[model samples]
Target: MINQNVTKRPVRIGLQLQPQHMDYATIRRVASKAEELGADILFNWDHFYPLYGEKDGLHFECWTMLAAWAESTSRVEIGALVTCNSYRNPELLADMARTVDHISDGRLILGIGSGWFERDYAEYGYEFGTAGGRLDDLATALPRIESRWGKLNPPPTRKIPVLIGGGGEKKTLRLVAKHADIWHSFADADVLEHKLGVLHGHCETVGRDPAEIEVSVEIGGSTDPKDGDRFRELGASLFTVGVGGPDPDLGPLREWLAWRDATNE
Candidate 1:
């Protein structure tokens, strides 16, 4: 149901190098490999603990890892797959992002979302408010983040791209229209089609061009390669797949990379 005529952005691939049950050395190796293999973006999630596998598993902090990635990688852009908006003060997060952007020489993408992991809040001593409240917090936090960016000692090396993830029709999509340069969702083709319409409606209300925002889709679960053509036809320009483990499996990444490169041609 995607209308390719709406936008014709180039296809790009992303690898969410999950920071769970893996050491920093392992992650660095994977991040290096992902870039070598032509990943356009590399991501790590923001969380205190593992979301899967072992209960009390190995994990690393998000912004710290991203700072390291800035120094380590030379080409690919890096970020948290989606940072929890509720965890840090908005201005502080903006400063952290500015620092990382400088380290990477402007190769940072700020991917964030209204947080949903309750256990993180409980263990980290954060308040796990209702979903609506969290989204409200995000709605308020984003402007503060931007305002802080403007007042920083030296501005961000570039206009750091903000990639917002989620698909809640009312608040989430509205925020996307108001703020995000990139809109990510774990949605299938049909659902993406529907949400894109909702997002466009929000854009109309806000007077922003619907085609200005890049559509990003998570691959591997509901999304298959055959769906890539369908997705591209619908204007999804970025595809991301998550990989994890001490010895990470990258078969899907290679396949997805191939699709991305082929589509770009």
Candidate 2:
């Protein structure tokens, strides 16, 4: 059971349409279906190639597909489950996010991280540097992203919500405390509880309210709402279900949405 004090917000569900082993047409169709089915957010990942299946499997770029999703879906907030920071210049990425925000009429969440995927870096001509270095760059890039958003021609339609994905106690959570509107992590309930304490500590250090940041977690394939009980009890409001491509099934997504609706009510 969720503590009444902690789970204050309405439960929201997200669908990550993995852009792997699928044609553009299929991806587009699924995006449409996800929106029609009442997803609060629609997400894709930032990667040059498939993360699983065949290494040479069919895949698509992240932002361009987000642009398409903006044009296609009227309601769901759209973005990468997280865009990798090293893939593009932070200022340019900020501009791109602003553009998509306009296209979606102010419904874009700028979910980002200090990128991993070595293959994306090596093949795309980016420096596949040390993890610590990448985190340093992300720490540096975020302010520039916000500054760029301020100077844009027309500016973003609204203050775009920043969603930071990662669980590093020292660096990542600190960044989340300083900048993020939402903090996403893959930690299970026990781990999430510990991380939330770390996050709250970071918030205190940074002079930000920890309650201002909505917690997001990956809810695995189980359709039973009981499977999400622990996470819900810990105050994870935004739950994401990932569906893969090339004839993907949305049954699980539907189940999760039902869970979301029931919980919210």
Candidate 3:
């Protein structure tokens, strides 16, 4: 049985501050509101172009914005949903994560993934290899990331939580079992149950305990108290609701905050 006690503390909240059409000022305001309203983490997508609206519309780089977020917000933890391995070398990524970790006083989460989004690869001159190949690259990168962290002149202020986001049954889940402190997926209860079973199998294969990893999901426009309850029942304690731009809406965020508090009570 899944341990309900794992999340007896107040449920944590995360917001993905996706930079689409909104200007930097608006993004800053929403991030400030998220922190003021007691969110546990603040995140942004690692994309170069607008993923939703106009294909070539307003967009910003990920790490620079994270650096800004680290300095801008005093309380909320900050990270990308998953930084693409293809964009930056693993050692450099580790250094960047460590820098942000210090900037936030040990409140940074490093969510990483094998690269997706072919446009990002093609436009940026990264080779869009087969999915399996990218996963292979990710497998190779993980150790280098850890090794670089250890070798850094000043190591991370704290052991920054490493979050791996994906649901691939074979290599991805195995990677999660081996290296992730948090596993983020988009599965519904039944699907999540099945994946969790696969993840458990992967953990056994890796000699790691599946229970040690936190399960998380991306709560989109349809989030509700019942949805949260359903996810909680399936072992997902960290629910992230994303607000994209043009103008980032905080209405759903407010709703989620209320639901989180009420559910804990």
lDDT of each: 0.90, 0.91, 0.87
Q: Estimate the TM-score of every prediction.
A: 0.97, 0.97, 0.96
Candidate 1: RMSD over Cα atoms? 1.4
Question: Candidate 2 — which pairs collide?
Answer: none
Residue lDDT tens for model 1, 1-265:
5655454788888999889888888999999998999989999999998998996899899999999999999999998889999999999999999999999999999999999999999999999989999999999999999999999999998899999999999999999999999999898888888998899999999999878899998984323566787777788988888888778877788888888777767
lDDT of 3 by residue, 1-265 (tens): 4556544545777888898888889899999999998888899988888887789988889999999998998989999998998889999999999999998898899999997899999898999999999999999999999999999989999888999999999999999999999999977777888898899899899898777899888887655656888778777888898888877778878888898888888
Q: Of the candidates numbered 2 and 3, which has the greater TM-score value? A: 2
Ranking by lDDT: 2, 1, 3
| lDDT leader | 2
Give the alpha carbon lDDT tens digit for every residue of 1-265 in model 2. 3335558978888999999999999999999999899999999999999998999999999999999999988999998989999988999999999999999999999999999999999988999899899999999999999999999999999999999999999899999999999999998888999999999899999898787899999975667666777888888889998888778888988998898888888
1 against 2, candidate with superior lDDT: 2
Count of clashing pairs, candidate 2 = 0
